[model samples]
Target: MILRSLFLSTVAAMAPLMAPVSSFAAEPQLKVELSPSSPKQGESMTVIIDPPGNLPPSDASQLTVSFTKSGAALAENYPAFPLDAEGDRYRAIIPTSPLDSHGRTLLQVSDTIETRNLAVWVQKRNFPTQRITLRGSGSGGATQYELDRVAVFKDLVTPIKYWNGIFRAPNSGRVSTIFGVRRYYNGVFANDYYHRGIDYAAGYGSPVVAPAAGKIALIDYEKNGFRVHGNTVGIDHGQGVVSILMHLNSIPTTLKEGDLVQAGQQVGTVGSTGASTGPHLHWGLYVHSVAIDPVPWRNQSVD
Candidate 1:
């Protein structure tokens, strides 16, 4: 006990004379942000990263991010795209609707050096029910719908094209039906007929505009037989982001497949062409094939 006390006293006395033990270097500073930070289910979330001032410009694109939910990795090693010349910052999109695998999803973002476990919140959406009856081209059965979704989901050809500016609203009218609403047809609940797009209660001749720049991927009247989606125009806004304008009375005579359109350009006029109950425009936005809420995308730039 005496020796132990003497040793402690000697060590304390020598501490001032000895150089202090080295400490670890400070961690790098990274500014990470998520927009629509508290996203509801079926919405898209964006992650923006701003690295420390000392980070190299060449390393900007190398700053990859990983996504997780409930401690499980949702996406790993996903490349973050640089938005500007300096390349000190980056951005990536997380289309949460298609992540149906997560029963109770908690979106997260993490890089090799930092983590944001509570990056965003995904809330449950309670939607009201709507009933409709089909006639004419809209009379097709589930077989056609199954086939159409299969087609649209396969349009992964475009490289991710950064949106140049804020997306504009297709129709200037009020929204009649919100996205992801439960549906009933012929007095029976239809599991397959969720309202996958936003509906605008426009008049029969109301004009619809393109929300962003892209080529016309399809102007389908026969693929699914005008019944499921009447006189539809699917715009491929490069990089797997697509926008669909449906229930058109007619596509512009000047507009054709493969034609590049500018944002806010006229695409079609509204009508109850297919199985629609009344004159309205159904505007659907998608990442690949998964439907996402168009609300946030409007007045927002992907760039």
Candidate 2:
């Protein structure tokens, strides 16, 4: 009886070890969620991904995303970054242009274990036309040098995210021109012209504040060759979100590039410095170098 009892104890101890090796392996678990499931044209979309339990925190770097529209591939594969320090979850922002057709859009999120394809319905948005006549002749377009200076940093992706909540209005004046408005410059229909940013009818020298916390990426003046983007100040709000303040009257002497600024902090004053018909402020918000409507960003916070 003693021997039988000892044998039973030994069998129970060995039972788990004798089971199949596959049982010990971790099961596949990769979940994805989208905010504002049905996105609209000129709006930004956020992709949240929860990696499998077995993947290490560093594996989040390996995650990649590609987009497809109307059976054709869109841009290059975009990388996903860890949203938290633990690396359990990741995030990516997809920017929609004003010209992107409204229809079914497909996105594929892939990892080591499995690849998930997500279908997104993009809603259509109508934009109005605005005709403007410059006081003096010719197009006051930005020079190649000025365009290059601003273009180099627009799509840069910083590792850290500085914004936490909704963005505030930079100036307290009423909006003059909304974004995405087609333009007839001087009565000749300018084929590729659409209002890229919002125009505020702020008086000369009105306080222009930072909409969100960020690092000052650029500060330039008209004398410095910023012909069209007169007296520009660009703040990088990390993770591909950037704010470009153009036609400013002045930027604080103490404020320089790479300086940290808080929301509502005074960075410049409103003015019609660059190609101005009058004194006003032009604020352009960009994601991944693509300018989208700032109204959605002002209404809700991105998680």
Candidate 3:
């Protein structure tokens, strides 16, 4: 007992002589940059985060982000993934809606230690209204079966990025109806309805090509009860960017799901297979399952 007490007293005497360990180290600062500081409605914006050398532990599992518009919360705890194999660059994409109000949008990015808020200005955009009367528009609205089938492909997000640079027109034709157009069917105002895709008035049996590189994710036919979205082809361009071609007359017998396709590759032919008055192709581009305008994508390249 006496020896133990002597050892304890010796350690206590030496405790004050040892260098103090810091319990409160400064938090690491992350570099956050947005591709377009000001984006218009129906456009996609990317958020990039670069951490310091010593930050983000070896695991670096999940870096999360959230968005708020005019004090209204949108997505919460949305994931941001490493852009490269080395885990240095992290990125996430946010898609703006045509109905979104213009103002400053706030993005909250967080890690284990700290959180940061990024400000982005959203520009105003206007969409025109179109009045149309269909002679035979099927059973009217989309059936539950058709909706369920299309939803699966629209929500798909492949980890790989298959596209680069600007996207091309799926078919050579004049745009009959641009995206985000409010529509009136038979003089009845379509409530909560806006054209989700651009209508290309291409000739019957015209070749329909892929706008960008991707993998064929879905192929549905009109004969299979896809009455609303007949002869549809969906392409997953990775990282939440997807392309959907609807009302195709024919798709090559050899091309199936999981096949890698190059930009401008022929996928099908235009037709009036579903919910259409005449021969036309509807091309819709979605980001994170939200339909956005393809004009910006065609005009500028998003890194």
RMSD of each: 12.3, 13.6, 14.9
lDDT of 1 by residue, 82-114 (tens): 656676777766676623432333433444555
Q: What is the model-wide C-alpha lDDT for candidate 1?
A: 0.67
TM-score to native of every candidate shown: 0.71, 0.85, 0.83
Quantify all predictions' global Cα lDDT against the true fold. 0.67, 0.81, 0.79
Please report the TM-score between candidate 3 and the true structure: 0.83
Work out how many backbone clashes candidate 3 has: 0
The residue pairs found clashing in candidate 1 are 137-227, 138-227, 159-239, 160-239
Which 10 consecutive residues of model 2 have the lowest summed lDDT?
Answer: 11-20
Displacement of residue 175 (Cα, Å) in model 3 is 1.8
Instruction: State which candidate, 1 or 3, has the greater TM-score.
Output: 3
Q: Which tens-of-lDDT digit does each residue in 246-273 have in candidate 3?
A: 9999999999999999999999999999
What lDDT is reached at residue 146 by model 2? Answer: 88
Model 3 lDDT, full chain set: 0.79
Off by over 4 Å in 1: 1-31, 51-79, 98-119, 131-139, 142-150, 153-157, 160-162, 184-193, 222-224, 299-302
Q: RMSD in Å for candidate 1, one decimal?
A: 12.3
What TM-score does candidate 1 get on C-alpha atoms?
Answer: 0.71
State the lDDT of candidate 2 residue by residue for 29-54, as single tens digits: 56677766656778888888887764
| Residue 3 C-alpha lDDT in model 2 | 92
Winner by TM-score: 2
* Candidate 2 residue runs with Cα over 4 Å from true position: 1-28, 54-57, 70-72, 132-139, 185-191
